[model samples]
Target chain A: MASTVSEVAEVTRPEQVALRSSLWHEAFLRLKKKRLAMVGLVFLLVMAVVCFIGPFFSPYASGKINTAMINKPPSFSHWLGTDSLGRDILTRLMQAGRISLTVGIASMVLSVSIGALLGALAGFYRGWVDQVIMRVADVLMTIPGLPLLFIMGAVLSEWKIPTDYRIYIVMVMLSLIGWPGLARMVRSQMLTLRESEFMQAAEVLGLRDRRKLFFHLLPNLTPLLIVVATLNVGGAILSESVLSYFGLGVVPPTPTWGNMMDAANTLIDFQKRPWLWVPPGIAIFATVISINLLGDGLRDALDPKQKR
Target chain B: MNALVEIQNLSTYFKSEQGVVKAVDALELRVHEGETVCIVGESGCGKSAAAMSLMRLIPEAVGSIVSGEIWFAGRDLRKVSKEEMRKLRGNELAMIFQEPMSSLNPVLTIGEQIMEPIMEHQGLSKKAAQARAIELIELVGIPRAKEIAKSYPYELSGGMLQRIMIAIAISCNPRLLIADEPTTALDVTIQAQILDLLRKIKDEAQTAILFITHDLGVVAEMADHVVVMYAGKVVEVSPVVELFEEPKHPYTQGLLRSKPVLNQRRAKLYSIPGQVPNPTTLGESCYFHDRCDQCLDICRVKQPPLRDGGDGRKVACWLYEEESVRGQ
Candidate 1:
């Protein structure tokens, strides 16, 4: 009874605050109402905190290989157990998570910025500017994404790029593959907004083309960009994992989730060393799924036409 | 009074798949300072095309101003640079659209929307602009001006949105306000309120208004003078009282009669016969000939030139032509 009263108090407090805030608060309130989305958000926050900070507290934080304890199963000393080199898989999973999440987030931001800018330019200035940008996006979109990433990854390995440098390059490569789809979405939205009568009202106000595009046009595309950006994070993480799995991305020395999984790929290791591969696999799956659920919730929450 | 906006031989054309559509063909219009000149017409009669042309807002894909001289306060608008035009617009000349529902940005606060033109045209500081926005919103007769300013467009009623649109339009205190059917989307009481608001603003600001609408009743209430258009051509121009009391051209007569009269219990309302000529195929003959009741033999051959009627009125019909028997 006391907890229920507290819960009601908690919900009403935000509503009171929302009355003083802007429409963003209203959207946030709606977002809070979506159960799956809230759970997804919570899970993502937990995962992020754990991945970014948990590795420091582990006993084997430096990951000095103790080959004597190789292929040990779940036990009190090591929560998940030991890897092929007898490094703590639990500690490595946390470390791998940091790399994977950084790649996902940085690439998503880079691609969303490039995509939205190009899309706005195309939609606002529809003659030659539109044709040039859209055609470039179209050309990029025609090539399949996974194969393109693989080919780029293969080039990095062929050039024998340093493993440390490869993570940054892999982020850039994933963003390169990611932009065309988002650019198309933003452009089509820009085209629709360009036709809206409010835009005509803007023209009449003598607003400069820059003001019209940024203040008027781009602001309207916020919800769509947010949802697309959220979804893109998942795709980026998955792509990075695949790239790393094939021994091309942040390679063996880097301790990425993909490389950890890759280390346990031998026949003997695959049959016996579940701790090596399963933890990283579960982390990748859980993170991507949480992001997708959050994206779905944001789409609903941000849609102004949707009913309460 | 000097002409605030004088449009001479303004022709706007669109290239359709079939042929070139002369949306506003060689149109002539003049609005004196502090006067309300309503352009009355049926649909597809080029009223809006003329308005769009005067604003220089014709989208490259939609259409273009083929030729014309739009003189505003002694400057020929067509000859002005794009930058100068941008400066002139919303500062010296402002416009409000018909659809209040869609005219405002749904995402922005009404306060911010009103402040936009104030900042853009006047270069006022953000704080000053916001204060002026509240004042303007109050001037438009909205209560709780501060609260209203903070509210987004979707939160307002249609009448309120139109009022907010008016506030934004008048923010820069423009010399000319181009109102394209500003009240057509509102209910009767709201329409009257909006019209009153416009009249109040015009009187206060001494601003010239180029009003466009199909409603004769609205023309009667708001227009100081009326320009009747048909098939992309101005058929008549007259003082509003004279327009209501004695319509000159056949098109104007049809428009007045088509409006339903109160207390006249008629089963069927009067309607103009025949359709407006397809813009793609308009010929040399008077475009109204097929639909006009007083069509002369000459109307079937050469088009009638606009003739000066007494009392500063103009009519473009063969009935007023002194050489009435030219074709015969």
Candidate 2:
């Protein structure tokens, strides 16, 4: 038994000394090696810049109604064509990109923050605290998210919530439904971490429960949380798009990618006039794919067992 | 010497799916000020559990102090509130675990980890705590203390991490330090250095240490008093020299005989036969009855109580029970 322990110590000790660097530093170094992830990162950055700045450069406003230019193909004058409402599809797409990205990021932040807190509390305290939080997550997990979102949107619209406020309401709704999975992830991670020697050391040091949870356990969980949050952003964007596509998401005038796709639901538009819908569809697909790639890269990089 | 910590009839049990496991049963031990008391036993002998039970660090979800009175600083530790226990821990009492590599927080800087208990218990300012931490790091013989303080646990070697653990354990100059197989993970040379450091701490601070280990060599080198455990019960208690020269219990005899001497080469190393009894269902008879080569008829029918063998020594065995009765 003693021999086995010393053998393990001998194997682990040298590697630990050789790799005398911070976890973030090692993860960053590993992340740099994955070329596709770097490309995805660059794409996201460029997309962010385009979404934030591209509308300022457009000749036509997102709300402008140019009847003559309506349903125009991808010409130089109306690049990516105009929508059925005579709105410049490119301008509206970029403008809607801002809202979609905002909703995605906002919802991700809200859900992850809530999830991480509940998970940390439940896992660190365990017992009834674990039971209460996890059972709530279990119940929430059973509810179909899309149908719930649809119901929430219908109820909110009936209540006459204004268009701008409804976007926030949609964010809250998505976050409410999105948190259970992330919460479960954080809880399981915290459970393992709570048993780790460092955490016990912290406990033995007479550190307060709050400090141990935040300073010791939470910091160790950052890599997992970051990966979960990144992945959730793509899901959030897709969920918002689906909600809007069904006319239950961000209202028409607000021009989310989901509502924008509402224009191409007709058989004629789906087959003949692909220009009116293809750009928004491609934009959503590209954003979600890039984010997922980045998330996958992060998971690989942050895994401590991964060799250099 | 005054007893700094006294544990009487301490029995710690774990509630598992199978049954209640009596991990430590009717254990009696003490650590005196300026003395080192080593609890020696093989694996699964409950030495570590006994140490953790002293600090009440046992997992409340599964394990508990079934029956015990841990008296420390003139108070029953079992009767103390959790808040009071927290105050006592890392201040009046501190503990160092076996796996040094895993015992320190990887994300936290050494300085931050060391400075925390000082700041928390001593109520020192951050600057003062930082200074105290640096002093501690140097005290543990780590060179370039300032620079080492900024480094994380992963950046340090196992020996260095163990020293850092010592530094942290001794930060508040605790009255009693509980070391649970502290040097087991380290190599022999580093092990000696850490043991020497612990000796230095004991001499300088006059802090009582409850040293728990499986290595009898460590017990000989460090212990003033030695407690030999078997099947969760302490079979013998004697001074270091007495334990080496005259072990009384069969289990203690088996433990000493099983250890290979450096120069006495043999075809096969000596080994004690039979495994430690399953703690949950230990029978009414002597726990060592099956394993003892010299087991008598009465040994198989009844358990032996721990009886004094004079000169501050105690042993629990049917052989000693007869001797005590004859003397009476």
Candidate 3:
């Protein structure tokens, strides 16, 4: 009788002999099924390679001035034509891509790191600590981002800061202004996870607060973090371009996408000379759209509830 | 033998928009070293609140242990430092919750989760911990320990996860295990399997268990001593066989009668008459007075205290109080 019972138990049990797919692997497989996101990813990769390496092959330097070639249209000698200073627009655009992409990526990293840390601390330890951090975030969030960025940019330019240091200032300004939204998002996410049974289990297991925060809570926040960071890149790039358009970002000679479009501000230059602004304009539009598409794809892919 | 855990007058309260809720009101219980003591009660009768109060794991912001003395391992748990309490939690005492699916971290593998308490309390190296984890998995009767170890919690069935939870709880050879309805979420067949596993572990390890359940059947099967709680207070305490055969309190009798017996035909199933009193609005009189079928005038105005009945039984009812006084 006992042997038969044991045999029945054995037969009823489903075989778990095959290795199970990990969470990340499942998310990756889901992500691959998204066609638009794949296209966005490919476009971003190609843009990155073009920006980083294309400048090396170009004949004209971003700073080079040829008086005779001033305002030349697209021709055999120069692709995308020349600007008012006779500098190659293609070379300047590539250089600007490097700066714009760097600032976007660096600021995103800085803001998300600071935001996620403060948010985790506030959400996990919810009393005076939460009140203080959330109050600060609230105050920052109430201020209009563009107006604040404009004031900071005007002040830096008025101070006659060194051209080299101005890029760093712009990066810092963007990061400082960008973190509040992400902080609040992370705080809300952490608050929901704080009451989950697994977190309570971790506490019962006597794991330290640090281990619970990083190992247990942080892994659950990965999908949210990835989606937020991807979207922030596009926002950061746009902010840098707007700052440079006002002649308050990286000084004129330093070549940023924003400064490259500053020449098109005049009605005459805007209508007649399409070469000066069209390429950079199109580049900005394409990059930002691609990033947003990719962010949406990631959001859908990482959501565990979404069926493949 | 000395009690493994002695909880005296433990009261936990929660603050809410409605008012302060006395979740556990001056609850007292004890567990011997190798015995299984089951706290049986209806839902919202403070079974889980009392269990969490023992470890001081109540949410600090919303709930607080207002007064209590949880004496374990020769020290008052309330007076101990936070660090000391943490060290004692998974080492000397451990808990397994009701919902096995949500209790285990989804991202963590079974082996990693099992090794956590072992590595934390025992300070074993990763390799040694891994080996010990495999042994524990096999001990819990999992067929392919190595394969199961590599899988995440979502990949396993509820029965498998509950067994894994048991393995983790017993990893440090804890002196006491608090299982809060460990098998309630499983099917009947799986429930029987889990109960068998728990009984085997208790005999082999000699670890005292404080089992909390709402099912009388579970209490009958597993308990050495039984505590019946109603509205956050103990109504009766007795030996298991005596509790079933000769219940003293009116509430205990009601509970036993409410259970549907197998192979018995009845036109209608039996259920207790009224709902449990709301915690926040409970008055100065006995909380169960409204629901008691045989209520005296004294039972309405004054609360009955738990008094000793003969043959090691204790009951808190106005009817029993007179008999005890006459004997005294």
* Lowest summed lDDT window (length 10), candidate 1 chain B: B319-328
TM-scores for all candidates: the values are: 0.92, 0.90, 0.91
What TM-score quantifies how close candidate 2 is to the native fold?
0.90
DockQ of candidate 3 against the true complex: 0.40
lDDT per model vs. reference: 0.88, 0.88, 0.89
Q: Please, what are the lDDT tens digits per residue for candidate 3 over residues B199-299?
A: 99899999999999999999989999999999889999999999999988888888988889999999888777888898889887888888888877777
Choose the strongest candidate by TM-score: 1
Across B165-278, the per-residue lDDT of candidate 2 in tens digits comes to 999999998999999999998888779889999999999999999999999999999999999888889889999998899888888888899889999889987788887787
DockQ, all candidates in order: 0.34, 0.36, 0.40
The interface root mean square deviation of candidate 3 comes to 3.1
For residue B51, model 1's alpha carbon misses the true position, in angstroms, by 0.4
Comparing 1 with 2 on TM-score, the higher-scoring candidate is: 1
Question: What tens-digit string does per-residue lDDT give for candidate 2 at A177-205?
Answer: 88888788888888899999887887788
Segments of candidate 2 deviating more than 4 angstroms: A1-21, A59-72, A75-77, A84-86, A266-273, B16-20, B321-328
**Candidate 3, true inter-chain contacts retained:** 0.52
